[model samples]
Target: MLADFESKHSLYFDFAGARPLQFVNPPQQLEVKAGQTARLLCLFTGSPPIVSCWIRNKEQIVDGPELWTENTDQSSSLVIAEAKPQHTGYYTIVVRDRKSSAQHTLTLSVIERPEPPASCPVISCVTASSLVLTWSGPCYDGGSAILGYAVELKEQGHTEAGDWREVTDLCTSTSYRVCAGLRHQGEYCFRVRAFNKVGASDPGPVSPVVRMEQRVSAKPQAGEAPKRPTCVTMDSSNKVKDHYIMQEKLGVGKFGQVFKLTHKVTGQVCAGKFYKGRRSKEREAARKEIELMNYLHHPKLVQCLAAYDHKPEMVMVMEFIAGGELFERIVDDNFEHTEPASVHYMQQILEGVAYMHEQSIIHLDLKPENIVCVDTTGTSIKIIDFGLAQRLDANTPLMVMQGTPEFVAPEVISYEPVCLATDMWSIGVICYILLSGESPFQGNSDTETLALVTAAQWEFDEESFDEITDEAKDFISCLLNKDTRRRMCCKEALAHPWMAAFDSEDLATTKCLSKEKMKRFLARQKWKKAGKAMLALKRMALLSKGDSCSSPTSPGEKSPLSPEAKHALKSLEQKMQGPPHFTQCLEDQTAVEGSSVSLSCHLTGYPDPEVVWLRGEEPLEESSAVQIEYEEDGRCNLVLAKVSMEDANVYTCRATNNHGETFCSAKLAVKQ
Candidate 1:
């Protein structure tokens, strides 16, 4: 029984090997343009089961939505419905089974769609009462008469089916204006459809609903203070005051006052800021601040709960923090053990600051006072007061000097092009205060502090920071660099060894310290092997082309013999020979206006050469006007229909196979 099984396997292998292991179709000669469809056929036969693949160039076109297939006992065909110029390349049919395999190559050519004489442009609503429409015109169509266009309108809110209503007719111009006189509070929808002699196509998608309401005016009410500062309140006389007198006063400031209040309905504790006498400018700023806060949703940032215009009062409600500001926790004498408590707290602050920087937001006023520690455990910190914050794009230059005197970066003080790196500088100062229990640089007055920062003179007392790890010192030193260019960025700072304390306990200890340790550890060894292999290949290629008189001395001197090398050599030789030839035959080929045309190339070559067609330097497959056909004798014929001025270019036919490759060219002229 074993002997019989062995004989059967041998016979199966012989049959598979004997059958031609080759792609049956001319995979290279077909062409199609973008937005056009092309079909590819894979023909093969075998006694044992065979699997097939359609590959573009050499890469397999895996089964996907764009690639569909139909299989039969004799052949399988792949249909690509919308071939794009990106699809232009050499295609191959690969057939294989356990015993043997075969492949055939074909080149694909894609053409550009003809420019339409009149385009049906996209339409949209610019405002509630007006609709804006745009379109592109065709390049050439005998200047066909654009009698007019048909505008359609339909309301999405209509309960029953609604019929489209055509409005004013449009001329050859590419734009249209539509005005609505509907209900002031009602939303209306509109769309535009184009028409010509051929007939009208489907209408475009409906435009966004436009309302007919007047723009709401947001102005400060009378009896309000001029500066309605965020998180604070003020009286009509421009002094700190609370509109809701019952809520306990938490703090007072120049522009407003902060009140700890409870929601009348929800009974939830919240902080309220009321404007004393709202100036128009201050009211506008308050309005914008509310809009900005409404869109922001982050865990580390204080949430703006609500905002309202209470006639004579402009109020902003916010989440109340119980733990008070980081400033109080670090500076208050009662919190003497703040150092150990601040280690974890400082980490959370850095995390929140890093998040803001990632969002392209610069908390220009980043200081201990602005950072509120909400959790009673003192482990959480929330960045507050977006009033001074700005969404900074890379191109924007710092135009205004902002932030506290001590924590502000030198560039910010200098009114230079400060970026997110400025925030990093502030974070560094905060870190120093948290670790050393004192500010890194200080003075009795703002003027003295500015002088100290400008001079860049500060002492780092090693004794005072004995408990702080050297890693932390190095991290701070890198971040505190006065030169903005040299300052450590948020991402780089986050990746520093000191910041990796949570990843490994030993990382925070000095025992693992070594000069150039991270550099040597992260270096790759695989790159060395890759370099050696590349050098060896280059040496072999050079020796192969050496003078015949020179004798081959070493085994390495001999050309490396591999399956891939042999296959490449065979392929190169085949491409040198041209395609097979056959008699040229034509029935009727003519160029017509608003129509398509075809051109054919018939040829013959030995060893069945592969066939491909090209117009100018580009392959021509799926062109609205071009079609290719392959005959039994290996001859290819190209067909170009409704040929236009763009089609007037030299065309070529190329054929390549295992034995050789060749090509032929012809010119197509469009008659006036």
Candidate 2:
């Protein structure tokens, strides 16, 4: 029996020598913002059956949702999806084997901007010339010392509340006196925010509105009264009609109606977007958009001149882009569509995207319809429609199924965590269409298209890409990579060979791409738009009826579950059915490098869940070395052929069915 065991388990025991547990890579001190993800890795190589666990402080860590540990015979990783101040501490990875044991430790620091001032300001010594107010330090200094306070004032009944004027810079004193720019008899509200090395915190609660008044020079005698002011100035209002005169309607978009406007003072033509309603949510969304516009400043981005509370609607005034849509220019009979022109537009787009990314903003919805030309020449462009834009931070990964079907990244379709690379994938699809006049992953319907996107199934048509340059193809490939880590960032893309070729004045390298197919693509898009409009109208009619059976049953007609409706319904069902559960969980496997290994599992879930393989936090796509198979009996297998040392790690199978997600993981130990 001993001889048989030794012969059968020879893969685990090294006959050559007794290998000792040792650290191949060790963890190091790490620092991250409070709301960011933090990862600590500890790698070791030794004999088989190495046991490892993570320890925080003196307690062993048990893997869970917010914080989890992945371990193999040779490696261990502690992942904090969203690091909090409490998570800042020393962490240890303890490894043990039959013959040896080892451990590694590291420190993690989670910092954030200071919290708001402790309480609202106390009003005192109110006069026309100066207003003195005092405040306390923040309740929390965000893991750092509070440097000072910043004050902002907003005059009541003048401009928008968000338009607060800064009073002073880094006022070390808790109390501040506002004197400059003070208006006599003006009503104003003041707010304060604390600052630290991490950054400035959100403003504290606003103080009660204060009314400024003139002071009496001396005590009044019996029956004596102070004289009234001789003149009074009315506060300026920020009504849309007061600032601009609305002209002809420019266009209609997903969130609002765009109209041409003339500035009352300068007589300059601009565009105003009037939101559909003044509901609280809609108003809040509009304000968020305005805030982003105020924060981001770039030539390639549509500049928000001003915003006004237009009664039932909120109107945002922006620069008038008269060049029409980029698609229109491509199909225009008189317009020239050359490779150089495409390069020019892409460069500008990258510049805009880079600016947004630098600000940690992701434009979730980036498509041709959102890109507009500045003039008929089509040389200048601006990216618009930021309704879906979001700021990415350390708190947690953003998971949203948004963006146009054909242009969305695979991660978007799979409801995976969206990162900066999500926008890169859209850019890739746009580039593909621009050069070939084709939508690379378009299918017969949106659902089919989304499925294609999830699979990363796309190929260049021979006819359309015949004239496209190899450099351009490579650029698109890098952007469309299934793994976000492998995708090119805006900065890298700007320096790509394809983009670099156009850095010089030489337009000689430019090749003219035939726009004939582009015209047809544009026509198809218009038809689809008209169809969508009809569908929206039909939906409204059905909604008015309030009948569950109002769905059209005619052949070729859409069902009640429109693509958007289906997603919502699926979400609801997911909550009802719960997450996927593994009936037969995966088991650990050991294999030598350059050998084949297979891990299998059985999971049960409703609505037919799709599996996403992950090697640590990064997802794995099907390739020659990795093959994923789904059996009819609900069994799934991940086969790794010719596995390398890099393939050694914790592999996870995450099953998601739109509404719910479940995951199981096991380690793969590869021996050299």
Best by TM-score: 2
RMSD of each: 24.3, 20.4
Question: In angstroms, how far off is 585's CA in candidate 2?
Answer: 40
Deviation from native of the Cα of residue 438 in model 2, angstroms: 0.8
Least accurate stretch of 10 residues (summed lDDT) in model 1? 9-18
Q: Model 2 over residues 1-672: C-alpha lDDT tens digits?
A: 433432342111122354556777565678888889999888887654456777764566777999998777678889999999989777866665544455666778788998887668666556776766666566567865566789999888867766898998668656677888788888888889888779999999888888788443222222222121111111124466766688999887667799998866667788888887568888787778876664355678987766667566788767788988898887777777777778888999998887777555789888898899988764889998787898776458897745667777777655568988999999999998998888988888666666677668888889988877788888898898887856888867998899865566466656667988887778878756534533433343344345325654543232122233333333333333445678888899899989999999986565456577778877766789888877644677889999999999999887766458788999999999
Q: Write the per-residue lDDT of candidate 1 for residues 581-646, one digit (tens) a residue.
A: 444633333355445555665554434454556667766555456666654323456766666777
Position 59, candidate 2: lDDT: 66
Off by over 4 Å in 1: 1-246, 330-343, 502-672
Task: Give me candidate 2's TM-score against the actual structure.
Answer: 0.50
Candidate 2 deviant stretches above 4 angstroms: 1-238, 503-509, 529-672
TM-score for each prediction? 0.40, 0.50
Candidate 1: what lDDT?
0.55
